[model samples]
Target: MSVKKALISVSDKTGLIPFARRLVAAGVQIISTGGTASLLKAEGVPVIGISEVTGFPEILDGRVKTLHPNIHSGLLAVRDSEAHVQQLKDLGIETIDLVVVNLYPFKETIAKPDVTYEDAIENIDIGGPTMLRSAAKNHAFVSVVVDAADYEKVAEEIEANGDTTLETRRKLAAKVFRHTAAYDALISRYLSEQVGELLPESYTVTYEKAQDLRYGENPHQRAAFYREPLSDQLSIGNASQLQGKELSYNNINDADAALAIVREFAEPAVVAIKHSNPCGVGIGADIRSAYQKAYEADPVSIFGGIVAANRPIDRDTALAMKEIFLEIIIAPDFTEEALAVLAEKKNLRLLRISALNEPAKKVDNLFRVAPVAGGALIQDFDYKQLEENEIQVVTDRKPSEEEMAQLKFAWKVVKHVKSNAILLAKDNMTIGVGAGQMNRVGAAKIAIEQAGALASGAVMASDAFFPMGDTVEAAAKAGITAIIQPGGSIRDQESIDACNRAGIAMIFTGTRHFKH
Candidate 1:
C-alpha cells in the first residue's frame, strides 16, 4: 500500500506546508484545491489543481469542486480488486492514496455576533465532507486525515513504511466520521433554530474535551471535562482558574452549585456549598458582610466547602475566608489586597469569572441530559423563577413584609438544593439547609436543628408540597413562624390545618421546584 497520490483540501492550514513538503519528499504527488493548492505552490511544492484531475473547473461559488466522479472513483477504488483498478485505468483517474481535509468553521461562524443566515449557509463545505467520507469508506486502501494534530504521526508513518498502517488508517477513518457527525450536528442545531423549532424531532449535541480531571467524585473513578461549542454563558466550565491546584470532579461540581446559588441574588451575596449542596447563603450590604453572614450561618459545614460570591471579594472578606480551610473560592473579581491575603493559602483554588455579575439567563432551547444504564433522560431545563404575583396566601395569618422578603430569598436558595430540600432563612441569609434526604420530614428536621436559636423567627422554604402535617409540626416545634411551599400535595389540607394550629403563616408558590 505504497503512497502515490494525496488530496489535500483544508480550511485549517496548520502545518500544511511542512506536511505537504514531507509528502512530496517521499515522491507522492500532491493534489489540492483553492487556497491549499496556492499555498503549497508558493512553498515550492509541486501541486496539481483539482480541476486538472476532475477536468471540471470549480463552479457554483466553489461548491462544486472535488465532487466529480474522477475524485470519488480514485478515492473509492480498491487496489486488490482487478475490476476497481480497471475502472480507474479506463477513466484515466489516478488513485488517491490519502485524503487530508477539514470542514469549514461553521460553528465558529455562527458563534459570531450578528452573523447573517446567508453568511452561515455559504460557509458550509460541500465537497470536503464528501471526499473525506469517500476516503474513509475505502480506508483499507486509502487513509483519511481530518485533524491537523495528526500530521506528525502521519508523516512519520508514511516516511517509515511508505504508507500509513491499516491500524492508523482505520483510526483516522473513525475520526473522520466523528468529525463529520459533529459538523452535521452543529448544522442541524443551527437550522432548527432558524425554523423556530426549539425541540426538533431529533436532537444532536457535540462536546469537545476540555481537560482530564484528576479523578471523578470518588478516587476510584476516572473522568474528563467536556464543554459545548460556542457556549458563552456563565458557568464553571468557562471560568478561568486564577490560582491553586487543578480542579477535581467534586471541586467542579461543588463550585457549580455554589455559583448557581449565589447567582440567585442580585445584591452582594455569598453561597457556601459542600458536596453539591448549599450549606449556607447570605445577602448583605457588601461582600464582606455577606461572607461573614454565610460563614456564620453554618461554620462547621463551611469547612473545606466551595464559596461563591456575586460581587468582588474585598480584603475583609478574604481575611474571614482565610480563617477557615476552603477547597475553592469563586467570584467576578478580587481586590488587590484580597488576592494578596488569600495567596497565603497555597492550596485554595481561586477562580475569576466576570460573567458572575451579569444576570443568569435561561438557555431555553438546550436540554438537560442525564445518562442512564442503557440510554439517557433528556428534558427541558428548569428556568422557572419565582414571581411576586405567583405567591398565594394560604393561611389566616398573612406573612409580614419582612417575612415575605425572607421567604422569597429562601425559595430561591431552595431551588438549587437537592430533592427533599428545606431552607430556613432570616434577614436575607440562609441559617440552615437540608438536602437530598430520603423523606421531606427528615429534611425539615435537619434544617430546623441546624438553625438552633435562629429558627425562632426564621422563614422556611420547601422545594415541594408537604406530604403530611408532620413537617409543619416539626417546623412549629423549631419556632419557624412562616413557611412557603408549592402546595400541591394530596395532604395539603392537613398541612394547612397544622399551620393554623401552630399559629404560623403559610404561602403557596403554585409551582414546585424539585431539583434532583
Candidate 2:
C-alpha cells in the first residue's frame, strides 16, 4: 500500500517541483517525460526519464510517447491478483503506485483569436487522458491526481500514511473521469460546430460552478450557479457583483430579464422587471431621464423590482433609485457619487457589466433551454428585431410619425414579456403591460385597464396576432390609437375591420415574439 514509484507528466506545472521533492524524500522514484522530465532534472529532483523505463525513444513529434504496454501495464496491473503480478513480472513491468497528469490546454487554444484548426487538434491530449483513465480504473491500488489544488492534501496523506487512502483514491478517480468527460465534450462540441451540426445524435455540454445559492425559486429548493467557459457575450453570467448580498434564484432571473429588455434600446434606457417579466421600460436621452420615465411607467410595480440601465448611472439617477426598495440595480457603470448614494441600501444587489456599452454581437452558443417534468426543451434564442422593410400597413389610416415611434418602442418591450402579452406605450416608455394570460382579449383588457387614462393616446403591441376582433375592440374601447402585431390569424380581417371602424392605425410585422 506504499507508493514506491510515481509517474508525473503535466502541462500545468504549478506546485510540481515541491510535490516531486516530497515524493523523492519518501523514496518514491519519479518517472517523467518531455518537458516535465527536463524541469525535474533542472530543479535537482532525482528523476528517471520515461525512455529509461520503457526502453523505447519518444517518436512522432512526441505523440507516440507513453502509448506502450510498458507504461499502461505498470498502471493497470492489479497488485493483489496473482495472475496480474505474474504478468507484470513476466513482461518486466514495474508497478506504478501513482499518476500525476493534466491535459493540454485545448480549451484555451481554441479560445485564442485566429487559432487554426490544426492548432486545436494538436492541443488535444491523447496520452494524458489515457494514463489518467488507466490509473483511475485501478484506483484501489494506484492513486491519480488531476487537479493541482488536491496536491497539498494528497502529499500530506502520503507523508502520514505512506500512501493515499482507498477513499481518497476513489474520490480522485471519480474526479478524473469527470474532468476527462468534460474535456472530451468540449472537443466534440468544437468539432460539431465546425461542421455546422448543431443537434447531433448524442449531445453533451459542461459548465463550471460559479457559486452555491442559499435557495432556488422557493426556500425549500436547493440550487447553484454555473457559468459557460469562454463566453464573451454580455450576459448575467458575466456580470460582476460589486455590492450587496448574494443573488437569489428569483433575483438572477428578474435581473436577466431587465438586462435583456434594456439592451433592446440603442438610446439611454432603463427597464424594471418583476417576477421575470418587464413591468416598466423607458428610453431617453440620458440615464436620469430614462430612470424617471421608467419609474413613471409603473411606480407601484417598480417598488421591489430589478432595474437595468444601458448607460452609466449618475448621482441623480442613484438618488432617485434610492427612494425605492429595489432588489437589484445593474448597469454598465456607476459614478463614484452614484455608488456612494446607492450604498446606503445595504441589501440592494449592484452589478456592473462593461459589455453593455458595446454593440451587441452574435454569441457562439445561442440557444434557450428550459427544463420540463421529465426531459427538457431547447430552441434558438429570439434574436429577431423589427425592421422597417418588414412592416405592412394593414389599417385604412396610417400611423403618424409620433405614433410610429411609440409603436416601435412598444413592439420591443412586448417581445420580452410573457405570452399572451399586451403592452401599451406612449412617448418612449411603457404605460401598461399584461402578460401570461390565457386569452388574447383578457390580456388586452388587463393592459387597457392598467393604462387607464394613459391608454387614450397610447399604442398597443401584441406578441402575436389576434385570433378574434375582441382584442382590437377592447383596445379601441380604451381609446388606443395605434397597434402593432404579426397579422396571420384566420380572422385577421376581423381585427383589421375593427381597427378601421375605430380609425386606429395598425401594422403587421410579419413575425411573432412568443415568450413562455
User: lDDT of each structure?
Assistant: 0.91, 0.92
lDDT of 1 at 223: 99
Residue 501 displacement in candidate 1 (angstroms): 2.3
Worst 10 residues of 2 by lDDT: 357-366
What local lDDT does model 1 show for residue 441?
92
Tell me the alpha-carbon RMSD of every candidate. Answer: 1.4, 1.4
TM-score of each: 0.97, 0.97
Give model 1's clash tally. 0
| Candidate 2 runs further than 4 Å off | none
For residues 222-268, what per-residue lDDT tens digits would candidate 2 score against the true structure? 99988877676587789998899998889888887887788888889
Tens-place lDDT per residue, model 1, 389-501, is 99999998999999999999999899999999999999888998989999999999889889999899999999999988999999999999999999988889999999999
Q: What is residue 29's positional error in candidate 1, in angstroms?
A: 1.1
